[model samples]
Target: MQQHPFQISRKIEYGMRAMIFLASQPMDRTVPFREIARRMDVPEDFLAKILKTLVERNMVRSTRGAHGGYALARPAREVSFLDVIEAVEGPVVVNVCQDGSSHDSCKATGSCTMYGVWKLGQQRMLEVYRHATLDRLAMSDLRVPEPAPEAPTRPAAESRRVE
Candidate 1:
């Protein structure tokens, strides 16, 4: 899906899910690829790419060989949401105008009425994400809500006219 200005990419979302799952698991435990994929409901192939980026960023560690899997490189408390987002998608920019590389492209750099708005918005977002550590998220009740029970259905013959 194409990501809007504020919306995070699917890769970043999946990476967050994967990170939360790992943080919830015992620190000593290394979760396998299949298990993370199943629990996060993330496609294995896509998740592999996300994981690779995270591993490269030093946010996640991968183990090879028998009984091998993945785990956070550091304690969950040390890893923040911003870290995960930045690992998968570079510095979190709320607007293109905030991105340094795109600064020259925009006709209005210092004169734009919305520049301050975007700057403040990006600052606030970064602060929130930076403070949202994985340990806190993992400790919260983030389990998927149970599916509601199905309503009772009428028997096929009951509502039908005999004629």
Candidate 2:
């Protein structure tokens, strides 16, 4: 059987998508869970569970009533990607050693050379995620915005002329 590389799963994808949708909404507005679920095409129950976790972590606030729903407790720029991920999925440690949960039964406790490499990579990933706020992510586009027009400035000898 082929071994699959460990990475963020579909749940994380759906959760992030749902969060981006929330971020897109006006800050003053509290979106209904059902509406978010429908718009994001995520299972209502699953998204609700994720939202509950976010609420517990104080990343989001929820209200109870006919008009009550969910909204970010603070500005999107104040919330980091790591906050959301950690709220729903717990800490992003890759190994038991990093989590300090190693047991005596484990044979490779102190002999793994790759552990150091993994720890370094993990730290970098954490820093990137922690520094990347939801506001930045919500505005992330691979292409640059339109550039201003300007006259060409180059010597005739160095620049190619149009046919």
Candidate 3:
């Protein structure tokens, strides 16, 4: 399926999911990648890459050996959604015009038809993502609801409909 232009990449999504899971845990505790993958329904291999990036960015800390795992590098409130996103996917620019300075080609503000709308929207997007931290997300109840478990349904037998 075609993705929306504004949609974040899976790496970003999984990275944030892992972050929230880590944040939910006690700060001092290091949880294993297997656990994180299971809980978040993310692929372990892919999650490993995302966590490595986070570790490199100092947003997450990792430990080796059997007793080791991963944990947040700082308090959840100290890390913003933008921080995780930029860490995983580089700067989050909505458009080329949203980046650069006065006129390094595609300036921040412009006279193009979509420039004003995209610029204003980009500014708002930046502000929202910058201020919306992990702790704040944890406090909010906006998670996708888990689907209810259902009993397995048996296929109709050949004679079931025959009176």
Candidate 4:
């Protein structure tokens, strides 16, 4: 299998999945971690770390006890893709030149011809991300399909042929 050059990290991917699931669920209902993991097909341990990051960022709320679980801290409409991505991956940077901290490293920060292009691209990317809120994603037709049941096999002895 070929790997894509530009791809989100597993952390970000899983975080998005969990967020969407939570958004789709009733705001009054607290979903269990196991249910989220199973429905989203994310590893439990990996989901745990992602959830921890989200919880710390105040994007998700966690509860303790039998009926307690997890839910979105804010309304789904208030949370955007940028929020989730930035929550997990930090600020999105199109290139090293776009990073303020790396401006000193790049000698052509101000004079590069491609600077405008990178800036425009970065701006557009962030705009799209900011526009894609959890509410929109949850409402989209992106549900995980249930697995098909396995067919029953016949006994080997019943398949014997007469000579």
- Runs in model 4 deviating more than 4 A are 1-5, 101-103, 139-163
lDDT string for model 3 (9-73, tens) is 89999999999888777778889999889988899999999999999999999999988999999
Error of 3 at 163 (Å): 82
Worst 10 residues of 3 by lDDT: 137-146
Q: Report residue 122 deviation for candidate 1 (angstroms).
A: 0.6
Q: Rate the local accuracy (lDDT) of all candidates.
A: 0.86, 0.77, 0.85, 0.88
TM-score per prediction, in order, is 0.79, 0.74, 0.79, 0.79
User: Which 10 consecutive residues of model 2 have the lowest summed lDDT?
Assistant: 138-147
Give RMSD to native, each candidate: 12.4, 11.8, 12.5, 11.4
What is the C-alpha lDDT profile of model 2 across 1-163, one tens digit per residue? 5545567866777778777777766677788899889877899999988898888888888888998898888898988888888877888886665675653334785787767777788899899999988787773431234568898888887787677
Model 3 TM-score (2 dp): 0.79
Point to the candidate with the largest lDDT. Answer: 4
lDDT of 2 at 111: 80
Backbone N/Cα/C clashes per model: 0, 0, 0, 0
Clashing pairs for model 1 are none
